[model samples]
Target: MKIKLRHLAGKVFLSLILISGLSTPISAQNLISNGDFETWEGISTDTGLDKGIPAGWTSQTGDGNLTLYRTGTPHKGNYSVFARNTSGNVSRMFTPTLQPLSAGKMYKLTFYTRGKGTLANITLTENGEKLNGAVATSPSDKNIFASPSMLNKEYNNGKEWEKQEYTFTIQTDGIYKLIFWPKSTAGTDGETSDYFLLDDIELVEFVDETICTLSEIIVKGSTLKEFDPGILTYNITLAKGAAIPKVTATPADTKASVKITAATKIDGTEPERTTTINVTAADGISTREYKIIFEESNEILREGFASEDRPEKFTYPNKTNWIIDANAAQNNGVFFGNNSIRPKGSDFTDDYFTIDNCTSAGILSFYLKNRGDNANAILTVSYQKTSDSNNWIELKTIPDSEIGTSYEKISLPINSGEPVNIKFHIQKTAGLIGYNIDDISLTPFIATKQENEKTGKDIVFANGNTIHLQTSIPTNYTLYNINGQICTTGNVSGEYTLSVDTAGMYIISLQNANGKSVHKIIIP
Candidate 1:
């Protein structure tokens, strides 16, 4: 009998084992002797029954045409068993008589194999009677144990060793033999020179007592933004000056125990506090951990496009550009909420969102995904201060080599604390499909009082195409054009003047002992 353990909501369901009244001990050793094929006692020949077979192993070839040898190429250790079929008949290798297994005890068989021939099936038999209901598992693919009499599991590892495992329980107390068929039974009537490499075979008693996952975690002071057993880490925002919440974790198994390391205090000194929950299963060997991060939420703006036709804080200067796409999946777009935004037309357009009175530097992050058929469509992200008359500073361009078909998180560093406007410009070149954007967020940098008081008073103005600055102390000044191109830079004290050859809006930045300050001026 094969007992398969299925999981739901991080809880392992052992109903099959409980209903059958079958349990195995936790400690057991490998029952297959000389299973590694490392002990060969005879010389290898072209064909024979007593030829170079590994100790405790035998083979069956219909007309005695299969050749066996010990090879130095092994997945591990020093040697592995290699079998070659010279005739059209199927060949198989057999294990020695296994130690007697209990009637209701579960056993697990595992081995590493690699080769070219079609490894057809594996079977366990006692006195020519096949054992039923064995389950085979492989990491390369899903479980393919369909028949009870024979396990038709084949892995085409092709020169690379792959591990395979099987689990089953015997209905009667008896000694058994395990067989490995190297060639398919039905086909290959005229096939020859087919080969198989086998190594690292093991059989042990299996006990399923390693389920220590939590079903649910609760916080007393605030609600979780989302909860999923598979997601172990979560970020929660607490109101400023609010006390840290009490946390409780519930294990999936009743026999499992949980320990919580709660945060003792929230004094607003640190930006965040981390709490951890550890769960230990009944066996005391299996464990899992979940973490909660409590942070003072200082979000500047967050847009998920839940219901708005367009983002509320966003302004579409082109007026008829992007629209809320409810069916993001149909268009191969990725979204976190109910919807995302995609270009309504395949034309070059610019759109922007503004955040006012931004007093600290921040990180701007969003999700962007390109259409699979997108061709030469470029999306550029840029930012500029609303009060300054300067061109947008380019942050990133999507659809580059780094972007994939699925939504990828794009994070950019915003170095300024000034009130700013962020722009997303899409230049659709040839293809009608463009990029999709969703889950836009901005988080300001936490600053100390000393860092926040860096800006000092300075007189800066522009007359015609010349910029003038009067500083109280020696300072370094840089003048830039509307396109963010540097016009001039120098160190000056008292009165300073810089004459430029262009006629447009400019920005002048001054840095001194007090710190850095930026000013905007127009030269018309």
Candidate 2:
């Protein structure tokens, strides 16, 4: 709890407070063996696998344009993978997996990566994608890969290391392989031969049982503004040695904060003090509340989005670099009145696209309408990150699709924290233009999945400035922003009158007896 002190002439107003991340589970095991390409010691292709490559990994370069070799950059150990693609040929690397992951379970793939130029993607494919036992660099059958939603990828993000994570549900009990392919930008040599560095590739099942993956506990002293609680449960914990459970009345998302005071205490003599943990799914006008019981615990926080690692942001980037043309039928955004243009190309495999960053847990949603040929005006959305950006270990060139002139909604999912540079290519412009777009927008949203027996439940709040805290159970707390910048923090619990002197956005982390709870606040 933080104590805000304001000296006014002679009178002094005193208020008190408590103060914490994305916690790595005490027990997290990577399913992929030798995911870090550090074991390439004297490994040769004398038998079957590729020479000089790490064990349990094989690469294939069709038409000899892409090459997968060892890199000095790594997110973990000293060794990593370097992928370079020149011209327009294809190169793919596959993971050795004679066994199948448990089906019906949720799996998360994460890795750290960076790139110099255009990058391809790392995809999850069926067992047959491998030519017999080794993974094929270019799988002939397009049906071998999983759906777009299940793929975790990475992309180039300057020279810095970025982490990406993707969560998906296993469909069937089949062997899954990871294929890495670095793609050339327009297949022009020296124009943009993309090369990427990857290290510490990991895929794990996210399961945290005994805790709801959507609910969080906040004492009346805490402030939950503009929040959404996915699952509802009441955790009745024994606030040992306190009276009234340190609460006056429940001032949840609906109730006002004025009702909470410091006089209240846990039901000291009541033996079992029920510190009413309220869950709120408030939507401004109305709220839905759920009650949960904690027999012998303090606080609990669970989230599917892992917002601490992934942040949310809204921006209107510079429009000068955007390729705008009359043939493309460009227009301003429906909301901001900003300009938007479609891709222009001529051939079947025309590469008319640019690489841009998508940082956070949300969707790159926009208003789009086809303006070119009815059957040929296609949209090929390829991204690198969790789902599409694990900061940068995976990559994908999503299949193309046709969009008509109905002004439809186009949303491309992005990973939290690990933002990927996306490419919107017009596969078949057909000697014409592409899409008429507007409202180039993005929203940081939560993708919380309630998988039974999951681990590491996360809770992240939107950006704000008002300071409020929950839980009398003491632990460490910290306040930062979406950019990983630390602000203010302390270790205490109670009511606090925060003096957000500056108008800036910040995130508050509360790590108490239960777990860690992160809150984002913007000071205006």
Candidate 3:
């Protein structure tokens, strides 16, 4: 049932837009040649200064050295890299050939650092013969940092010089060797006297408009919290024949796609209604959008997800072997990096961590800890009985019985009313070992406010294309659809019309014996 239908052909509406195209490729250059350090060489003519070779670059060990070049402290012209190791060194730097990338594409690097002492870390490798560069710090599977604790600090003790950048993508194509390495944060004693500087260093080829989406959009118990993912517009009032809400969007690059196309009915003459959701990335055409209006209002939505950094939103590009672990956690603190990636280095991955939105959400708790031998770990959920109808049905899995080895607590169920996306997956091969997850949560599905005196508290929303219901008492009213059948019934009190003959989703219940109330509608 899809045709022309622009602006409202008969009427029915919904909202959701998680697009992130990032199209901006008019040109490209910057490969890194001497990057700012302004190029320098020589021993300042026999050690008068200039001791850290910075003219193009290379490093297996310090050849033609001059003290690691600082030239009094230049961030732009003179020179940078102030390094100085001794007690078992490894000072690195490479960048010369490059120019191959292009498979999947994306790039971007930029640089600048500070940390004159303590933990001055940095390190990023390539030269792919197999990628994972054997691991340097964190984030992997293909290009996510890979190690050194997921690298990202620009240091701030030498006072200033921060400026970082990341972007990444370009999985594999060829011609490698990039490595920058900077080190120092481990156990100390790289023979003390360690310093840090580095300079501008750009790198190019980008187009990652970001769009991590689903900032905060609750459903079922309602609560839009002003919706503003950078002014994509989100409104949300509902009441007058209410029922036209289903705005689930979860795309932070899972190949990304939501292309906006949901509008669940309801239109008395339109007080307000809008729809839009066109998230396109993964190289289809680079897009972005998210509208969702729907006004009217009488009130009836409780809202969900409490908040407390909300588990740092789960981690890395938002859920992906969800790293963080901080050595280990069950309650000890840092959680994530699960599916068993233990006592070897810190964490490992196979992938799968999703956790998006979740409206009526019925339970999917967390905290597990299997070690291997296939202890089992997989939980899926994206269901949708009916709210705006995306028909997403996976319902349940939570198998492997419940996994074990250490941590516990694992809840599972998840019925779903609207925004719901939950994944866990865990598989191991090459030797085995996988499991970890903590505090994860979602228990919503309780909306029960209650109020009915006719022109005031809760239930009202009456207009046409039929969706009229008042309520003072009289009770006895039922209208269910979305598969439960029973389209209509009688005996409501102050008002009633609800004929939603076609389009989707509806629920209207009234009670008499002193209490009972419910209203959910949509009929564009």
Candidate 4:
């Protein structure tokens, strides 16, 4: 009964080791003597094991001519084995029992290996979770033995003992299994004439900790302008402390500001405070500063409405880049218009478009239909900055023959503040040319480099000043004052010449059927 009891305890211990080893290969180690490293150490060749080290070890697979020698190796306890692959397409593996690891503790591991393989990957896992895995090099493995220091460096070949080490902290606590596989990759199924050597392995825990730190934040924009009701848009950097629990943005110095109205939102978050607090320094130079609070709410909507019109636009997603006012007659859901509002010879004279300014530098885009006929006839487009009828400027004179007779898109850049107007004058000579204009939207062009910028009121170009205005179709010459009253009109073709003779700040407006644009010019 005493002998039986001892045998039972030994069997139970072996069973526990096997059960744990089967859980995950990465976390399990074959701790038994010679359980891995197929080195036939003390075994003799008469037993069918062909390869034996010069010192005493033996190998049973792949060219049994290789041997395990007592070369005073480190991890292997006093000796190791070396093999050379001259015919290529060769490999070897060893099973070892590893120790357990603790959670949240960093560790360092070291081993020795050498070879010339086109592919190499090392994997290490703790418990059931993977710790680290990475591909070493690409198009590699020229000389497997070049230096003596590479044996322990993890990669590269060497002439002497090499030590490869890795350090990492475990996020989970449990026993881990490690695997080292190196192979010479071929296109389909080629050959490998490389060599690999293995030696002692060591694992140790690390004590130093250096993490949980944050990086500096930055904020910027291209241009800042006031638009529709003084609402500003800025691309702010959501900093580190921003995610802290229960933090909120106050308008005053304590935690909030006072300039924000109750209906206002910061960074698109609905904050408990309603003021334009200096939580952010609003710095316009270099790197601006922003206060991050730990709040359950956000200020800015990730996506929202358009605050201005983009006229320097042509292409778009889904439907064409044309949109119309829902309440407007005709194309209520946004329609397409050819080049000229009216074809060349049709006497259908009503062709016009409008662009509502949302920011200082606005964009207007539309499509033109080339009826496949027309040479020199032109279109007359005009514009005025304010709907009050003052500071009007003739933009361009587009020929009827030039009307959408070809497959193409057109964009016009408006130079003005928010709330400006646009107009188009149609003209043609020979064939019929028309156009389709829609998707007229206005939004602030928030600069990805500048801080939050606000749009300002419409610019006032003084009377008699020369200002450039772009349009979907070109136009003739026209003049207006600050009172929405038409001053002078011209029938010039294609381009407008503005030599107005008045004074004071004013707006030079230009337009086409698609939209309108405005620019501020000073009249001396």
Candidate 5:
């Protein structure tokens, strides 16, 4: 009586065997030795072979009607078995006897193949008797198996290499051999130029089927949190106005499949969005799902210098003299993103960039680093009111003593109630090395409402060229002219008055242990 067995296609079949749980514990070990076809014996020369055969494999060439040789063209290794038919007679290549397979235990045989014309027929045999059904039963000397081929034409004929796999279970326990027929009567009639190539063969026993996980998840235009197969949830913060990201998810197992679902709308429509990725194991039953949450950031302006083009909100008067170095990270110990800006030309010259029309009170922050050791290297941060664009007021200055080779964050408070323009100036006194800047960002200032309430009772006003202040407790004060230059700073108790030399709009900052408050005064 014929043994009953099931044959399934490719990797999907492997997954089914694993999920079916018809065998003992699963083993990743490949039962076929020299499966990669890397080692060969019986070679006559470097370029050609005399009856060359792969180790652990034997061949029947029908008395040279079919030629079997080692070819450099391979799917993965240095060589693969190449078979060419000179005559229509059948020729075969047989795998060494495999370890005994138990009845009721599922097994999978996989290999990569590509060629022209009729390729080959695959069969499982025991003691030279067909185990899986056979294709040919005539020509007593040539009829080694039954009739009709197992591999179909759709899978065997193609210019590009294709992976093929077969899964089955035996009815009895015994050693078995896998056979490849280059010209089986069951296959299409062979031609003189018909050829076939084979490599990377594998045989394994299936055990379990619950592998439902993603090996990788990629979101275009954004970086996802570090991926962990065990972690199914992730969060990403996108810049405002950024396009919805495209996601690609890859399953951990080749036999498994993945599907990704992304947000249908743009960012401004919703504050937050969710993208889901689903993975299904080869068994078509075991499954897993992952989620990525995207939210918009609350920054008015942020520039990392990740590209060559200057930011739209910024103006560089000497554009050609500036350099946006792409290899900042390798050149300097610290850098933000991929690039950083620096003055490229003559030393001791001023290189500056200006941000136009900043309308809100905010905190301006950026990274600064000096590449040279010159003591005269300096950076000046300044701002100008929109009404008086010609007059710039100095906010802060960073000298070489404070600047280091590594990047450091510099933050300044903008207390202006009117629109202003911000500027950054860098100067290097005596060397080619200059200052590098990156990661500039402006965030809206959050006022201390409670502190403002406590200081509300304090009266501050200006008349003529003098400013007057009355406070319940001792307070420290700093005065800045519209040009952003410091006018005066002092500590006072009860009442205080300060005189200024010029007439313009001035900013007075009063501070005590409770908090700080800023006031605008017009000096005539």
Candidate 6:
């Protein structure tokens, strides 16, 4: 009994430990700002306030007083510290007798003051050096804070609270004293000191919890409309949190889609975290989706591709590829010659044609049909996955010896995502230079085992001439075989596995005489 009790206790302790390890919660960090004056009591040089002045604030000896105003409610209120000069020497200095400030972060300074003072200047100094470049509103009024050289303006009157806002972006990160000095050398004349009413002095950091962030998106479901004879567009929104999150996306299947991904950071923050995914179909249709994630390093956007025109011809620093003549000319030339490259092209063609549905993955098929008497043509095709067009690698070079008789088919396999641009040239290797290109197609090949669903009965076809019918039929429909022959037909509009004993190419057409129309399918 004693041994059993001990064993049970040990098992219970081990279980508790395992549960604690598995249930660890994610750590949370403080989003609110530090260096705020809510907790300043004891006075010190490092502290941002001084109690001797007014609420730990001290203004220069004068008839005017710097007021501390609070906006909004108690715990969630905004405080503004201002200096108002009623009548005295135009010089003013109000220093916080407690709590130091943290540099590098941005701080908002709001204040309002109006007086007959000739000149006014609010100098924010740490130790003895001025932190920010001075900004003077009333320059002519020597009794007010002097504006900076760039902002050469003077205050008009010393009454009424004139609103003004200032943002201080600290360069160096550290703790330092914050002092507000408003001076007017206007001297001790009968003129009263210019009024400088201040308010709403609070320091807080911005938290990015409301910025837009992209979670998950489907391009097919979000298409807006069909234009350009069926050019569909899809625009999907993302989850924009306080700070927009950056994004990087990979398509599940490249054969089904062609897309480009990009991201932008939230406003007033480094390293934009919002991403935009652009998708363009083979029919020259395009759409975009945005995704948001944390920040990271990436290339800055210099320019956007022109989608209106097909890019068949490309030049260096220019990422355009041409598969056929576009009749478009480059700088100071009409013919295609390689020069001026992103990687700096030299002695290259100036004219080129861009292939529609071109991709950098798998294999791309190029059909070059012999039109002219050119037996062996010299054509050079270069491709790269980078913006620098010069970085492109030569894919295929058809010398005078490799051109075969009759129509020839060329296949080039590529693995790239950077160089979306490609350049091509057809030259006389030995004999001729004319060849017509037709049926240009880009096919992305994927090699992966597809798992079969529901294992039970098995049906096999001896001949390779298997007819796979994929249709969207509504009700009862008839499926006809080759030579106007009707073998087996069904009404279902789903995956129908049929067995055909014959070994030949068959054309299967589905027609509902009383319904919409006829659908055709070819089996080889």
When sorted by TM-score, best at the front, the candidate numbers are: 5, 1, 2, 6, 4, 3
Q: What is each predicted model's overall lDDT from 0 to 1? A: 0.61, 0.46, 0.48, 0.34, 0.64, 0.35
Instruction: For candidate 1, write residues 1-524 as lDDT tens digits.
Output: 22233444443322222112122345567788788988887764543322487888877674425567776778899988776654534566777687877777777677877765445456555534422222221211122222332334444566688776656665567776676665532222322222367788887887656668888776762223366778898865543344566788788877789999886555443323878889988788778888887765445555555454555457776655667776647232222235677776545434434434344445666888776654556788888876774767787776534567787776565665576778777766442656777777665543332332354456776667777677779999866555545677899998888887778766665678765555556678
RMSD (Cα, Å) of model 2: 31.5
Better of 3 and 4 by TM-score: 4
Error of 6 at 348 (Å): 30
What clash count does candidate 4 reach?
Answer: 150
Predicted structure 4: lDDT: 0.34
Whole-model lDDT, model 3: 0.48
lDDT of 4 by residue, 186-259 (tens): 22122221234566554556332221111221111111121111222322322112221112232221221222
What lDDT is reached at residue 95 by model 2?
Answer: 83
Count the clashes in each prediction: 0, 75, 39, 150, 8, 106
Q: Each model's TM-score? A: 0.35, 0.34, 0.24, 0.27, 0.42, 0.28
The clash tally of candidate 1 reads 0
lDDT of 3 by residue, 188-277 (tens): 223222346667776777665443454544433233445565667665544334466555666666655766555555454342366667
The CA root-mean-square deviation of candidate 6, after full C-alpha superposition on the true structure, stands at 23.4
Cα lDDT tens digits, model 5, 1-524, are 11233333311111122122322336888887888888888875432433477888887764335556786768886887766554554566778687777878777777877666343455566646532212322322222222233432323445567776656666577777767666522212343123367789888887445678988776762223368999998866544444556788878878888888886544634424878898988778888999887665444555665446675578888887678766646233221235677777465476788988766555566888777546466789988889887899787898868878888777566766677889988776644656878877655443443443475655677778878887778899877665445678889888788888878777676778654556667778
Candidate 5 local accuracy as lDDT? 0.64
Q: Best-fitting candidate, measured by TM-score?
A: 5
Candidate achieving the largest lDDT: 5
Better of 1 and 3 by lDDT: 1
lDDT for 192 in candidate 6 is: 33
RMSD of each: 17.2, 31.5, 24.0, 19.5, 19.1, 23.4
